[model samples]
Target: MMDALFITLQVILAVIAVYQFVFSLFGMYRKKKKAHFPATKSFAVLVAAHNEEQVVGALMENLKNLDYPKELYDVFVICDNCTDGTADIVREHGIQACVRTNTNLRGKGYAIEWMLKELWDMPRQYDAVVMFDADNLAAPNFLSEMNDDLSGGARVIQGYIDTKNPEDSWITAAYGISYWYINRLWQLSRHNVNMANFLGGTGMCFETKMLKEIGWGATSLVEDLEFTMRSVQKGIYPKFNYDAKVFDEKPLTFKASSRQRLRWMQGHFTVARRYFFPLLWQSIKERNLVKFDLALYSVNVYIVLLTFLMTAIMGIDAAVFNGPNIANIYGYLPLGLSFVAVGASILTFMAAMALEKVTFKKVYAYLILFPIYLISWYPITFYAFFTQNNKQWSHTEHTRVVRLEEVVQSKQV
Candidate 1:
């Protein structure tokens, strides 16, 4: 009975994982027609900076040269409790800067909340608000695409996120690969079906009315996911803009990337705990498949950790029951389920590369390390699940200055 129960549990996880994998596979075939909208909405660009002196100025410069009417958009920078020259740099460029000083209210969520309130009190109201990190460089036509989308009637939108220094280290390479995979396989797949897209922390836009209605109440470490999952309950879906590209600076070292990913894992699990049950119940009660999809996607970290734990328990049983010189259960047990998931992941990334025509030798070389990076997530997920309360946000340092032109040329790889 014990063995049967364990086998049944593994079978359940394998089923859910396989279902998600198949959906992702199905999402690869994007057939939806994109309706172009006129470019006319006014936007307020928001940047929340914390000691980002190294790269904030470059971001402002990139904004000033965007291919859109100057009058259509304005930039705002929030130097949140920075003891550095981030504020000075913003002021030197004659940009609107807000210096926040409340130490208790830390992280990007608080900074965004403060800025939204400030924007609300201003004399002129913006039709939409777009967000970017201090280290991000916008593609010259990013705003134009966003403007087109906003004019066409998409209320909330997440732009494409690319990396700046993909060749800086193996970690950066893996990070870049992860983004491209998610961008092509995950977001585009959802968009292909006219479903909601998940918002990254940066390179996203929200309608002014939506922001006012919901407020930036998602103060978790991963504010973007928090906001996306919570807001879907109200039937408002976020859309995607494939052309609005923003090059983000990825961490160049494992230690740095681990800390950054740890926060993400912690925040993902935390938000899942709070919203998954309610959202799942609502999805079934109302027959809303979009919300159901979002609920399943949000709990991915938990699913992975659970898989490892169940596999571990099986190993323990193999040891205790077999006594001395116990035989391995690699073939008999469902450990192959994990490998199947990993194989599906590799195929997903390879397919994304093919879709983008990424034949670059260096990118292919870097992609070989993706399985290693994917496996490392298991340890980090376990660590984060046990230690989620130490939520003092750790900011990933960024100093790379790669621009959109490099991204366009395909030489950054």
Candidate 2:
């Protein structure tokens, strides 16, 4: 019975691994050259902040210098539950700031929903709405690239996620590397294969009509993932725009990073539970590849758990059962395959870094530290699985005050 159970589990894991491996290969497709278009669509840029007085000003300054037409895009800062000078700073910059003091319905998702209602009530109309965190810095061509994406028939678009302070600490560097890897392997791959792309909280643009059609009711901790899943359910797939870059601040310490990831995993599991079955049924009923892919992606956390279970099971079988096991049956083949997997991962990371124009020498230490950082996610995700009901938002404090020019200069180097 145990042998049969082991084989069943191994088969399940092998299939899942093969699926992801195929998707990773899809990322190797050449990047589509982005075409510039006239800034025809007007955008209402929304920045949700919670006492983000330190970095909000820098974002406002960066928004002011966007390469897109000044009259075409308007910036609004939603100062959600802020007891600081965030609103004052926005007003000082000659921009509008919408302040919300609702302690009960806090968080970026609620703030966005509230602000959307306010925007809809106004006589002014916008073609789309773009979201950004208070600590993010947009490249000058950010809006322009989004405009091109819209012109190219992408209704909902996710801009490229870049790191503002990758060299700040090991935690930040790991986050940076992870984002780079996801951008190339996950986002770009999905884009190439016409699969659904995910919104990275910030740097996401939603057409006003799409927003009204779907309604931004994603009030989960990871509202971005919830919204993406909801949109997929409604037959809207977000497009990934590699040309549009948005620089975001990452957590500096492992504790801070783990807490943020825990919140994300909790939300991830919640979303998967809510949507997995529906997506699976939808995929089967409609014979939709997009829905099927999304359904599989939703349960990725479970796959991680299954991987841990497999390792534990193998260890138990070797220890408790004693003598040579299935692993030894293959002799050095298992060990050789492990080396191959490690080598493949290293090559993939190198490719991601090179494509993102990151200086490898500068981030070499972080590369060595990445295995520990990646391993930490397992414990965080495991804890988050049990405590998924805890919806309390633990915000990561961002104090990195880097400017857009500095980021741009560093990239050029």
Candidate 3:
């Protein structure tokens, strides 16, 4: 009876996975409609950098060349406890860069909060505030599209972030493909159905007033997720804008990738424990549909972890009890099918790539190794929950650099 019950729950979760897949497909269809709105507002572009001396100059150059008028957009770089020349490079270029040193408050979230406080003190009131990491290179039209979305009544907008080092190594290639698929399909789908979307740390724009009302503050390790969930709970779902693109570097080496993934895993586990119950309770008490969405998004990491555990248990059962020792045929069949379904779901990343118009030739080489990358998260996530190492922000290294002209040429063919 216990085995049957386990098998039943597996089948039910598998069905929910299928539902999410379908939801993603519909999102892709809806994304084809161009986001249209007038651009007649000013913006404050906030960049948080820590020891990014090598790439800060280039990022400033890219910001200078943005298509938006200089008077309309102001770029602010916060050098949070940097020992390097990150602040020097930005200030050297004549940009308004601030050097902040706080031993007590350390992390990108704290830096952002400080910057927000500075903005509030000034007489200037920006229509929107867009955040980006130090390494990201914005497209010329990034601000223009973000302005459109803000004018169209979106409180928050998440732009697409593509990798600059996709062709450098297999690890980087896999990471790049996963990012592209998620932004183009998963996020686009969720936005289409009015569901909450996870905020990719950089390239997200928030309305100035909304940020003020919500209070721009995040001390959590995964400040992006915490901020996103809080916004959703308040009934402000972030809109996805695929037309606004930001290019960033992928971790070139496995050591670097592991460190980055470890932080993400730890942050996810922390947020799930912190917000899951509150969101669930809020959903039940208020009968709020968006509250339920926020709760589901918060618990996704746990769900993935659960799915992996259940898969392992069923695999053991199939090997030991399927042939002669057990007469429970129903238990084996459903669990076996569940494993197949899970395997197939992992392949959906490939399908998502095809839908995004990423060339099959460009992605085929890394396809076979994709599953290995997916499974790697299991160990990191497990360790994150158990050990919880480095709750403080450990920024990933970004050395890869691709020009906007290169990205345009690649897309042209």
Query: Compared with the true structure, what per-residue lDDT tens digits does model 3 show for residues 1-413?
Result: 76666657676666677767777675557446665666688999999999898888888989999988788988999999999888889999999878899977889889999999998888888998999998888999999999888878888889988876576777878888899778867887777777777788999999989998989666678888988888877778888887889988788777788889888888888888888899889899999767776787788778777767766666776788673332333455777785776666765676677676775355568777777888888877777777565577787866655666776676556
Per-residue lDDT over 1-413 for candidate 1, one digit per residue giving the tens place of the 0 to 100 score: 66566567667676786776666765566554766656678999999899999989888888999988899899999899999999899988889888889888789988898889999999999999999999998988888888878778788899999877777788888888888888888888788778889999999999899889988898889999999987898888899887788889999889998999999999898889988988899999999999998898788889879867765666676687653232333356598765876777678878887775664566677776777888889889999999887768888888777666766676534
Tens-place lDDT digits, model 2, residues 1-413: 76666667777776777687778777776565657787899999999899899999999999999988899999999999999899999999999999998988877888899999999998889999999999999989888888888888888999999899988898888988999989988899899888999899999998999898879999999999899899999999999988789999999899889889999999899999999999999999999999999898888888777767667667787799883465432244578887786787678877877776687455667788988998887778888889999988777888899998898777677
Candidate 3, position 74, lDDT: 89
Superposed on all Cα atoms, the candidates' RMSDs to the truth, in angstroms, are 2.8, 2.1, 2.9
Q: Which TM-score value belongs to model 3?
A: 0.90
> At residue 369, what lDDT does model 3 achieve?
77
The TM-score values for the models, in the order shown, are: 0.92, 0.94, 0.90
lDDT of 2 at 218: 92
Best candidate per lDDT, number?
A: 2
lDDT of each: 0.84, 0.87, 0.80
The list of candidate 2 runs beyond 4 A from truth reads: 316-334
Which residues of candidate 3, in runs, are more than 4 Å off? 1-5, 31-35, 314-347, 360-362
Question: Where is the poorest 10-residue window by lDDT in model 1?
Answer: 322-331
